[model samples]
Target: MSRVRQILDMNAFDAATGGDGAVKRRLDNLGAASVLFYREPIEMVAARGAWMEARDGTRYLDFYNNVPSVGHSHPEVVAAISAQVARLNTNTRYLVEIVDDYLEALKAKLPVDLSNVVMTCSGSEANDLAIRVARAVSGRHGLIVTDTAYHGNTALVTEASPSALRRSPLPDHVVTVPAPGEAAYGGEDIAGGLRAAVVAAMQTLEARGHGIAAFLADSIFSSDGIFADPAGFLQPAVKTVQAAGGLYIADEVQPGFGRTGDAFWGYERHGLAPDIVTMGKPMGNGFPMAGMAARPEHLAMFCEDVGYFNTFGGNPVAAAAGRAVLRVIAAEGLQENARRVGAHLKAGLAQIAAGSDRVTAVRGAGLFLGVDLGAQDGSGAPDADYTVQVIDRMRDARVLIGAAGQFGATLKVRPPLCLSMAEAERFLEAFAGAVSD
Candidate 1:
């Protein structure tokens, strides 16, 4: 650990949100980092449904983070996990019907060709495994990812991520292309922009004398301003990569499980089939369960060689959680809920943006929306002071929101799939009040 971390530990945040305001001399003496540099702080003690309680007993509506796809501490999901733990909780070596059922149900949500499953502990691990599968199946060594994108913090995925990350470096076999958004050459032709980026990736592979193992993308570009461009653009790119004997790996860590509303997987919107789809974050509704789906042939390669294994992946306990989440998602009709609520939220943001110079634009689909805070002030001169002020104001009004994209100007609103229309209305009302203030 760094000296800064050491200092933080020594100077433990004593108060709930450092409520006591007691600062340790050791921490005061050390250097600063993200934890120490937070501007809007919330001392959360508990959370349920769409609301979270702060240390001071204040209630904050959560309009950010899809990681808990279902509501927090959902009774059904919790019960499923508890029931499984009370029974059997073993590994892959065991003959387990639960594991098989979980994988099977999971397959039902993925592209038909990406049918086989490999469970992991997190999205980063799933992405890592997906890359490994691509490399092994294609006999290629190069990987391509979007610029300004974020896959995970794993060494390889981190390097493949965009420079927005703090400090990530990949090995020689990795290449990058800008995500199709305002920053890249897409100009609204996001799929075409991705295709162009794929061309550059192909060139990169040739230069390395290695075929591309995979072309990995977050279907709608969630980490890069939620860029879900015209649907069919990715097909040509996938074709090109397949021609080069590569696989398309969709990192569905964020937008999977009906986040996009129209489909279970965001890649579906692109009108292309991915050979591999890696999922995590919301799989177990916060239970640290993740997995990847690949065509059976690619899976055979791994089974043939070393034999894939994970101590905790798909353990009976994890399987139960996964099963419950899958059941709830379908039974509750959360996909349709996402569509209705997402549309309402986005429309509200667009309406609020009109006649207001503080917003550059609003874009996204389903339960995932991004509000581009214009740099221009009320007089049309550049001034992000409005955006900054709005975030602080929203926090004060007991709502949680986050920032995204390359410039950090867009306010991200990715609520749980179960968030109701009434909650959407509350969020919009708060946002409007913040803007007006």
Candidate 2:
């Protein structure tokens, strides 16, 4: 087996083909970077709502994807994309009403101070540009993020992403702080810990002659094992950055578009307004669309120094798709649905944990929940091996899920916002069976 395949559990690989011939053929053409899930990747044919259909006619309830936030192939979103593509699709240089409409609607959801929008093709591009804007505005190059954060895949961002730095060293201009979980729980002062971390990082950066430029964080801390609780815990960190003459950049790619259910944006839940917010994933409901929202004053510096223009960003087709998503969210009341269904799902998972010895901590807000799998010996250590086994078992039970956290021992349960109560029940039942068996 190749190195990547070796990293994945061989026992979990789907042996439906009874051989590695198919895998070998695909690997020969696509190369090693083609990362796939499971010991045996599912041959998916189609998806709708919260269910994905496999080539073998198996239907798996999807609790792993947030990209299709509204739902897979939603009729309205599809119609909008089809109509716009057929009618016209052009770059942002041309005058377009749809783009203007989307920008206005999106800005309306944000704070009035964030009046500027710069569209990009992906979350990576959005973060990359946001970094540039922060550097120009603050006139500094130092950046800080969570210890295990995964911001994006661009060269500049990949260096800033500590998770991506597993194989490589982080750039000198970047600093990392412990995630909120380490200090939030365990009877520690969450805000104080966060403030100290930022202060330490700023001191180091200043000593090296690179004053703090920005303190970037994924609102949900999705990569740092989903540390979201004790709402308003992030206020101290944000304030610390501002006091140090740095921008607070909120990475909303994972927790934006009402995924948290309590608020339209995750930062809103903490009641802390960010200087710059980057969004993607659910923006176009699976379409390649992303952008950053910023306060006019902060963006003014960047605009004056070096204006940006993307070729395909904010195009007519993307705008139409974005608009349709906004409409569907309101029409279907998916945000409230997430609140209700997420609560029900979390409660059910809690019930399951109450009876099991392996399941430990259950945390998250709205539709973004994480369940921790711990050692059976009562050591409180992450049991990543057990997590892998549970994932394989859930696949057998036709429930699609995945893992996260520094050790990959936490079950990452983020379904489409449109997930129904009945689907939630079905997943709970399947999960119970997977764990009990």
What TM-score does candidate 2 get on C-alpha atoms? 0.94
lDDT of 2 by residue, 37-91 (tens): 7777777889999989988899988998899999988889999999999999999
State every prediction's TM-score relative to the real structure: 0.88, 0.94
lDDT of 1 by residue, 1-437 (tens): 10111111211233234322323332455424334312534557888988889788999888776877888888999998898889888888889998999888888777777777889889988988888888899888888876557787777677677643454355577787776765567366666767778988778787988769899888877766677655566788888898878889989898889988988888888777788988999999989899988888889996787767889888888888889989999999998999899999989999998957787668787988878776543543223345556777887887887766655656778989999988899999899988773
Model 2 gets an lDDT of 0.86
Choose the strongest candidate by TM-score: 2
Candidate 2, after superposition: displacement of residue 52 in Å?
A: 0.6
True-vs-predicted CA distance for residue 74, candidate 1, Å:
1.0
